[model samples]
Target: MKLSTIALTIMLGLSSSTMAQPKDITIRLVETSDVHGSFFPYNFITRKAKSGSMARVYTLIEELRKKNGKENIYLLDNGDILQGQPISYYYNYVAHEKTNIAASVLNYMGYDAATVGNHDIETGHEVYDKWFKELNFPILGANVIDTKTNKPYILPYYTIRKGNGIKVCVIGMLTPAIPNWLKESIWSGLRFEEMVSCARRTMTEVKAKEKPDVIVGLFHSGWDGGIKTATYDEDASKKVAQEVPGFDVVFFGHDHTPHNSVVKNVSGKDVICLDPANNAQRIAMATLTLRPKTVKGKRRYTLAKATGELVDVKELKADEAFLKHFQSEIDDVKTWSEQVIGKFENTIYTKDSYFGNSAFNDLILDLELEITKADIAFNAPLLFNSSIKAGPVTIADMFNLYKYENNLCTMRLTGKEIRKHLEMSYDLWCNTMKSPDDYLLLLSDTQNDAQRLGFKNFSFNFDSAAGIDYEVDVTKPDGEKVRILRMSNGEPFDENKWYTVAVNSYRANGGGELLTKGAGIPRDSLKSRIVWESPKDQRYYLMEEIKKAGVMNPQPHNNWKFVPEEWTVPAATRDRKLLFGE
Candidate 1:
């Protein structure tokens, strides 16, 4: 009787399988990362028409949802959404009582899920915490752990069931190197785990709990090699996809470089990885198709095809509905942006900063020195190929002048440590100058490098010092290029004696590894090295100073210059032409 019952059950299962043909299931995930508050087709800072924005992105998303059933479409954002436009500032600081424009806009756009970016954390607990609560959809962070509760800080992963009964899961994580760049107070009670470790553990739980047919990874870290340590990598999305075995699609951002490729996991199964880059310029779309596979005489759904592509939002027209719906908010932002703070006597261009000193770079350096009263001030071309017209300097113009809300830090450093920091900076900024004809800048023509604010290296890390008279010799190599003669006060520079140096919080926090690796200061020991820290962002002080002065005239310090004029003069001229025509 037992043998007959087993035979009948097996026969009935086979008959049911033969009678019913399982249909193919599809799930489409569209992602945006590093939107950076470009919500409209206009640049609030420049007050001009820009190429891409969330308005334009909305148009494309609407069309995508229409073509593919809305039930099968999932919209996600990787991160870096809370900073950048003057409008964002208007909502973040000025209109603090109301719902943040970022959360409100995303809610209106119907974003299914999002991840908090490093920049979002920079807003501190007050802003990001409020923004986090305001979001309609769950903000995901598998690696962001709450130390108090010892649980996931946010919704680690979100799962949705498609109309065809295909369970799709999306996992989110940010880089573990947040502490290396941000202050402790900002990310208080939050600890970031390494991507691979978190991904592996999270995958195990997700596989057992959700039993998802399709899995997607939405990460905020770059592809590879941002900040490498023995324990963690700042950009480890690619590494996780390669090591973890479950993902069908992985989307990442924060490097601001577009990528669409495939990586094989430990199981030798292909995982599609996509990045849309920054500023709402593009959207990464991934499609997953699942088909039934016979396993042990039972049917199970598995990923049959996974594909990804980046769709450009630049060419798409802005949705009128989006603009009209938020017209009142846009007008309010414009009112705040147009409030004139000061005036400029002369026009300054950041393009001139690449070759050597420029009025724009000097203005910021001078501000740092005066504000901190330090012996030396380090400044970078944060503006990066922008210009300030010789006219009214409004709040909007300040955003263009100083790109980030980095606080000024005054740190104690020996003359030797200072020199080493500059060595690292110049190494990344300029070439070896093997010959006069060789490009002075280490220009990389690769697509990814060129997209980095028109420089081979990130221009924000191209730090130059004021209050010291120095010359960069074109004939020397990276470490030997800088030659310091004397301090600006004509005092003898001593490598053994400690001196107060002024820098931005980003540098002090080891944003570019200049302080830790170049200056030989340990990351944990940086706070002790600080002599003083500005109460607010350096830009705030700069604005106050400008407001007090009413009319500001900025000039290059000319305290430092390039040596071997025969080599430097021609190289600077030739390279400027190569970089920007005419």
Candidate 2:
């Protein structure tokens, strides 16, 4: 019989036993990860679709509480709660002057504990520190430690005694990749221990010191592969099962894949692991039954099999009262989004290439170049949203496009840095440009260089604009030959010149390990010094910008080309069979 089937049968048979009867002690873990500060149900794109909203999630949590009683439940956020949507920006910046609505809503929801995600660090330490003070729940992470202070920045682990007096040890763990991905400044003093080691150390400590009956891992680290082989994260969870000796259940997050499976550890014992995807769309439910006993002279417990499912929110009734309050926030955001700030005579489009030029990308570069009046400009193409249709765009549209709420900032880059940037782009495309058959356009071919570029140079210039052109030479490796030919103005770009480029404040400050390091360029992009008269809402600006361009029709601009310097013609590079001969 399948493990789940057998486990279920065992539980059913033991259901009404005097010793196994359902005790007053029940534990329900409701988790939401990678919410990214989406408190309002605003699309920020079409401003139509009902998504990225915490109101609905809040309603669902309320319903769960009603059905399962709050005294027996714990609401936990798996992390990445601080970034993603514009409300994060609204709360971090605009609402900095007021109480953060996102925090208010989460606090109101009564979260018991949470772990951090890498994106949460993007908010910078000061902001995070300030906001953390407002949280009622203990933020847990055994791995994230301050090198200078020699203490974990967040609570490493804590134990909770549930209603029926079941002492459960909850250990939180954040991914160790935080330092490698976030801006250097934000993570300067932070050091992450390997996930498995951290879990082992903490769980061993808890077992020896506290000896909780049920040990639950509120792991913010993700499950890397299927349940069998150890992905660094899986090693951590499985190790907890084997080394720690008493782990009953593990709740996972960060990777956003939903799964509930039993992982057999080195000792050939089983541990239950659960992960439900992000955005508050689903909840992971694991029901456990335990029979308390005194073995010899010590209290021992019998733990049941771990079985779970991703509870679908669509099937639940939304809390209407909560929805009404969240709806008001949405309405305010919408009203703020509708006001037009600029106009355009032509329709300007962004590029749609998985790996080529985009008019949508052009607008962002244009804005960067124009704002700084730089000789050349750069920004990541993935940052943009889906292409807009013809008509008046709104602030909501801009927010949707730049969904991450990356503030604008300016940075100076030297000619050499510029060349390095373009070369990196080429390297990115070359890595994935495997044309086994020249006739077949590989579906894996993508447009943005940064997507595949291994190098982390090239700072941001956030002046989003309407017209720009450039070609990248992708053939050469980093350091010498990669080139950028300016296409926006159809001019032979000067290589020896320095340009002031505007970019999102995050990138300007070297978020994503941008070229700010050792580039010798002065950063004038500090939040206080930068002048931003535009409201937090961007839909109006997007509409205004599009209107100025008029009659939007984007043409192929391969003029900015990247030919490989060291070209390798693969053995399978022969032309493929064409369905309709071209």
Candidate 3:
């Protein structure tokens, strides 16, 4: 054969082989956020196995990987994994000398990356710093910068390569509102930058340097576009998706609400945005299809389609091996949670707080007043409908009572400001009743569904005041609802008098905007107004108070009441049944 003919034949064979390769590839990305230490299919509060768990989520991930090919699947956690149940508390505080169970589980599940959450930072440097060091995968936090170095405190972002040489760059960002919710000592040397600004800067760098085929943002914030009183952007995931152009997909949590949609960017291109909710109840999945195109006789891939959805994991079965591997830790947590601290003389339920003052909230108020010796105390139910029966109160019961690791805070406020705060709370918590059939508690048809009635806002923010007598008139408008009667100690209420008020750090730091907006207090001056702050979480003090008392007999202070009892009482009773189906 001639040499020219042989060369031509070889070139043809090479071209044929290249053409045989697939023209397109589809990859699936899965995310879990706000895991909050739910590694097993068990609820510590109820002391029973439940459906939501990382173990169950692992099973779903495994099934999806098997169906979609392991190389084409990537798993990531958005954040809030360090603190919630006793399992995490044990590893974080009780058994700090050993390996972190949360990190170990993430490593075992083969996570690609994770973002830092405000609650994770609330665990303090010693806990999260140790956990971050031990994690197998990179934990990204581009906005959480160190003051000393003026650079990212953790891995700003990470890039992973698939089987087809497709590079996916995942960047992580946290809410800048950390300073507003957390104490300075917890995040001492770190500064959380605004999400939009940080995303713009990070995306530019990633596109320039990595030139990744896909850019995914793992944010530990919500989808709200509005700014809070403390930060430039508290929940700026939607803003980041709208303003930043490089991100192909954005996965967010922190609001604990499930959301999935495609948002239009500044360039008029669509970006996938997703939030899987909290405690492994759901998982967010993003799928991208890349098609190969020949440019100058070289094959290149471009994203053809991107879509996102939230998958509910309520019915998924837990992975047996995953559960078995961590059975000892599970048992340890169970035993610790069951240890009786003290006894409650009567059952305390949160349902009563919705209508009038309940022992459930009054107990918290009592602890705050006792701990701080403040002139007045304010509190709200952190959980919507949690209850504790009359019996021995275990460590787990405390978790049910106090949902978050919030510290006790006492600030100075005038009587007028306190009244304004109550007015705001009542406005959000109650509705104007024109007749006896009208609903006493605020009910929004827009927020409710066929399954259950939902409040316009979180019921946890429905605050009530103690140490003073007041009345909420359901027939009046919002600003005119709350009327101060007198002090609980039989003294006349003075609107001009300054008094110390004890509350949770979240309230004092403007989490619900009651203190800053309602009270008309300057956000920057809030820290200086602090009369006293608890060194540990409020739950810690509650446990100590319980241990010291040995017998807890929680009773309502009866300082506040709803007016026009003839109309309000029946309406509240009917609404309670409608809300709880009891």
Candidate 4:
């Protein structure tokens, strides 16, 4: 053979070998955040089948797995899955077992990894510690560190491999505000670090050590405005995506808002951030395309395209097999929730609480004062429009009345501080009416939407004070709205006089900035102000109160009202009709 022909033959053989290499692959990541224990199609509170549930999400997951292939998909949960409905509460407290129903369901669903949420911590170590150990997949939280070892209390992150030569790393972080809303005893021996600093440090370490192809962030915090300072970084997912360079995709929860968008990172590259909302309404889907490349005689993969979007599971069918597996537990919880504990002589509704003193809210205040022996009590309607018809009261009714697992806390506050707290609460609850035609309550376009007419602020934070005669003047500005008359026992109100006040642990720990901002109490000093605290959840105490009372009658204390009823009543009436309809 000729020399030129031999060289050409060798070149052709090398080219053919390169062309026979395996093609590039694609991987899909599916995530659910803030499931909040809505596993079944049923709404345990209303006792009706709801549109959003984990059962529906399972169907969506099965479809994606089949389409993309099981090995090419990653299934993750972003936390807040241990509390909310009767089923979770039953497994958490009522039934003492080796594994919880929430853990069982997630394990059976084949979750690749998960994270811990604030609510999951609210279940205390007894519940979450056990549930964490029972899970098959790794539950991560890099920011939750043990004080003794000064290391991560849980698995910080998990690294998994997909089709040939591709490695994906998922790092998890939770909001550092756990100390602000929970007592020290609940989260003892562990400290939650600020998310931005934690994320930056963790990502740097993971990139150096793992050197994976793609980095996914599973954050249990939400994306708020551009506030990234340590003290005010409750929701820092947006800041992390914008400031951190290694993250390719970020998933967030804890705010209960659905979002899917791209933000610029430190390197000026676009990074996808997604939130699937709460109650299993939607699932976040991120699709990444990888292509093989040969550099310096080494084969590697490069991420070509990355996109994130929320997929609604409302129209999807429930996974029948999964539901059938837990049918017996579901039925037992339903039976326990329906067991009658007491009787109400008259029906009370939550709508009345927005206007002034209402039987619905006062009933809770009465329970707090009775149990704590405090001079005054403060509470708000946790549910927006829940009501209990006169006659039979069941465990379900207790859940509707007190939605959270907050413990009852009694704190010492002076009269001046109490007045200031009420001013802040009413400022968020009502508006300064320029005239009768103006709206009494602050309602935004989103609140007035055709689907729902809710308040701009969470109605649960619109607190009302009992055991004192007061008036809220809507004509005045925020700080000057409250006017205290006298105590419920007929003593003149004194700003300097100290009094024992009963509030939920959420407020006592400054969850809504009520105690810190309104009462002028430092956030760090909140725990010192607690005079007494209930052993169990406030709802448990309320249940015991109802059983002791036997025949319950929910009545308003009528200690406070909105001034200028001529202007306030008429405006509130019109707005209520517009907001709630008749």
Candidate 5:
């Protein structure tokens, strides 16, 4: 089983248990994060057996509940459950009239409380608002505030009382960097507060009003050092845990890396932090024990022990009752996923996109150009490693071909801005190959917890331009790598001339900082640059266009390639094996 970096042992501030007159009290929290709709043991997209599922997590939770009693065990989740698979899309769009399968499943699992993730917000207000209404327990996001009222859009915190007169207050906050990725229409009227500021303010409120014995932070943010701007931090869980004094245990997600650590708060108190990676593969469990003590001749509780670990759920079989309970919904999603959407004349692998122009991304780029009739197009591979074979394509294949439900965006960009954007992308993607032996890809210097060869930046941010002939000189520095020769149609590419560009909604809204940092466009002024946006998502159009075509012969545009082949050719082959083990 794969386990993420387990940093440190659990450290306790305080704990409570449910034993009428017990000498020591122990409280346990079982947390799952970024499940991404992996409900069953089967992978709906792959049509194969996968490592983890919420059904398995349910089995483990049931075992723990039976052993510890429900009163002492609290089931928690750290969101991002609304996207990623055909099942979520089914419930999100197809079965909108019915209750969301996510709500039903989490409700059946008896989740104590949960936090709203960025993807949940990405589903837009209609979907998340409906799911939020259907959930039996509250979903928290203290930092997500209503613009009009200046109050939290959702409940800031929820208090759960155990049978043994113990109050556990759970405060939830998500990453405040939503504006960088999402369009305003998706999260309209809600503003995100920075994690540290939000945590400090909420902590003060919790101490004053609730005055609970133990505080648990269920943050839908990741570890520190994600995207940091002067306004907000995208991954501020570590920062919040370190700065906020009252929290006993902090469970975070959204980075999709499991971790366990102990960090001292501002008051110099020990705080346990844990993050369970995405897809229900593992969960974080913290058992905190508090022993009775005397303070000023009064009965008080002192921390005895605090231990947390990442429990692997990969080996566990799917719980039969859980599968049976959601049988209808599961079957519906499977049927939808399996429905034939189109056919492919040849297979396209996303792996090739990393090297240069490939059919995988070119298909998307070509489709965008046809749809928008723009002079230029920009795209990046959404999936890390995925393929669509030369045969009948299903809805599942469309999901792999296009990951996010981003709308198609047609924007205007100058030829100079286009050059800058490509430079920034290659800077994140490829390293300066000074010699033939130097790596072509910009892999990270250090290994992450899972011992994987991590990229210097997210692959989804490695945008490449189509509709123009260009060469990226591997020996050149960051800003000077890309050299545009001419348009794909043999027209002169003037740097000063403006051209209509097709892009994904995320990019148009300033995701990956490509437009803002690379193209030198101001973030707030982005909307003015957009010429048009499709009503439906890119995925839907990709499916419809392919279906209309009868069969797609996927091929790379061959519009661009890496220069100094003496270094880049062998480097590409070596780096491919290093990254994919192929």
Candidate 6:
């Protein structure tokens, strides 16, 4: 049995537990997923953030180990642990020339095994290879195979023997959707097989070879109600529980939502599956008790008792020692925050649902217009939180509000394409005609797409600012909601007019498909047009501009109306009249 990091810490106590007819060693599986390289207690830019720090998690892990002997514990990270903020980028691409904070922290903390997530490939495979080599424990992913070697670089499954001599075979699998969203270069020669097939084959092999006491699947794919399809779904955890035999406890990820439920499969067997929320904001601890159970013909041990908790980091104090050690790194982020990169003239805030001349959307629009050098440009309205208070804004504020780290791209659009884009927005409202009461209606329809485009942080809500006048008829299909009223300069939009539009690369690459299906100027992909600006820096400047222009108005413009334009045979759209019912 390999001695885990915790076990190595208290070797003397571990020996006693080892010598005595080892009692059932309670394996404290501490899982942190989608950490995105948040190791320090303070935000790199803010220098004062208290929540979602890796050091705090480290403190808890240490405390947990002191309470529960090493042989009784293991830590696992369910992918998306690499990319997100500037620090990870700085380390992976610039400063340290490495991206293995996960490996370093896990090495120090003694994580037993982990699975890869989608964002891990964002910095490219070279970084992954460099960092992966430094891991003391196995970074398991049976699904991630290198075509060059035709073998799994990371360990697929690991059999961990608890202090009581009870062996548990844990298999790790990354999300099969990696190739779909990741850059081609990172996963160029790689392939993500179906999750079902991966789970089936790996579990079968582990059952035959290891034949351990309990089977655990540390999966990076999310639970999608296990809908048997080309890939997995939310129920995937349950589906694996039902379909994949020999697995008792399953830890899932990628959704970044918390789900602590014990679901049973069709075989009259129950398995506990848990998904810890992202950002190390929450830690999931699952306690499993190994007990004997009978199969068809033989007696075997199985995971009998399973219970878990989502330990909020807010409840834990910041580990001052760890902060002191990483002080330089933390200070570097603060410096990055204070650097003035750009500026704006005055505030341009708005209240309309689509196009506004508000401080937030106006800045985005101005950037889009300036970058694209277009006569008119459009932007998505993001409404994550209420307006920034009358004070200085920070980078953390930008990241929190404009969570997506999207690449900048520009494109050429025709009048037809512009209409199509507006139509898409109209369709969004039309679809929610009946459910106008749902505050998060647009977010629900667009979150997955936005997240894929790394536009989670770029999200805006409430008012929309447009360069053209548009009317939406809720009675029509989604495509015909908005009627072009006029253009920004009060010029009538010519359907044949060619226009250049600046947007993030994600949007250009059919992010929301806002410009994809249009009978207009064929989009010309401009790779280096829109510069990726720092959210924090932008927000800080925005605060200054807001103060300069004390009184602001984000008034509503209900001038646009949705008249049925698509369906000749009008079908019941959202089963409602007003887009936003009074």
The whole-model lDDT of each prediction reads 0.88, 0.57, 0.87, 0.88, 0.89, 0.60
User: 1-582, model 5: which lDDT tens digit per residue?
Assistant: 123222222112122233345568787888999999888888888888888889999999999889877887889999999998889988898888899988999999999899999989998899999999999999999999999999999999998887755678899999998999999999999999988888999999998998676789999988977678988889999999898789999999988877999999989999999998889999999998877655577555566889889999998988999989888887888888999977899999999999998999999998999889999999998877889999999998888899888999999899999999999999999999878899999998534533123687888989998899999998999999999999999999999999999999999999999999999999989999999999988888888888888888989988999989878989999989987897
Report the CA-based lDDT of candidate 5 relative to the real structure.
0.89
Could you tally the backbone clashes for each prediction? 0, 47, 0, 0, 0, 45
Candidate 1: misplaced stretches above 4 Å? 1-22, 162-164, 292-300, 447-454
Could you tell me how far off, in angstroms, the CA of residue 182 lies in candidate 3 after the best superposition?
Answer: 1.7
lDDT of model 4 at position 310: 91
Give one digit per residue, the lDDT tens place, for model 6 in 234-304: 23555676677667778887776677887776666777788876777778888987655556865456565
Q: Cα deviation in Å at residue 41, candidate 4? A: 0.5
* Runs with alpha carbons beyond 4 Å of true place in candidate 2: 1-26, 51-53, 58-63, 66-69, 184-189, 225-246, 295-300, 314-316, 344-355, 383-385, 407-582
Top candidate on lDDT is 5
lDDT tens per residue, model 4, 1-582 = 698999999999999998998677788888999998889998887788888798999888888789878888899999999988888899999895847998989998889899999999999999999999999989999999999999999988889776456788999999988887888889999999888788889988998888788899999998884223446588899988999888889999888878889999989989999999888988999999988777788776788998888999976789999889989888898999999999999999988998888999999999999999999999988876779889989998888889899999999999999999988889888889888788788776655221124676767778898889999999999899999999988989899999999999999988777787788998788888899888899999999999999998889899999877888999889878976797
lDDT of 2 by residue, 362-448 (tens): 556655555555555556654322555546555555654455544455545555665554444344334333343232122232222
Residue 39 Cα positional deviation in candidate 1, in Å, after optimal superposition: 1.0
RMSD of each: 4.2, 8.9, 3.4, 2.7, 8.2, 9.8
| Model 4 stretches with alpha carbons more than 4 Å out | 1-19, 163-165, 225-232, 294-299, 448-453
TM of each candidate vs. truth: 0.94, 0.72, 0.93, 0.94, 0.94, 0.73
Model 1 TM-score?
0.94
Greater lDDT among 3 and 6 belongs to: 3
Better of 1 and 6 by TM-score: 1
lDDT, candidate 1, 56-100, per-residue tens: 999998997798788878899998999988887778778989999
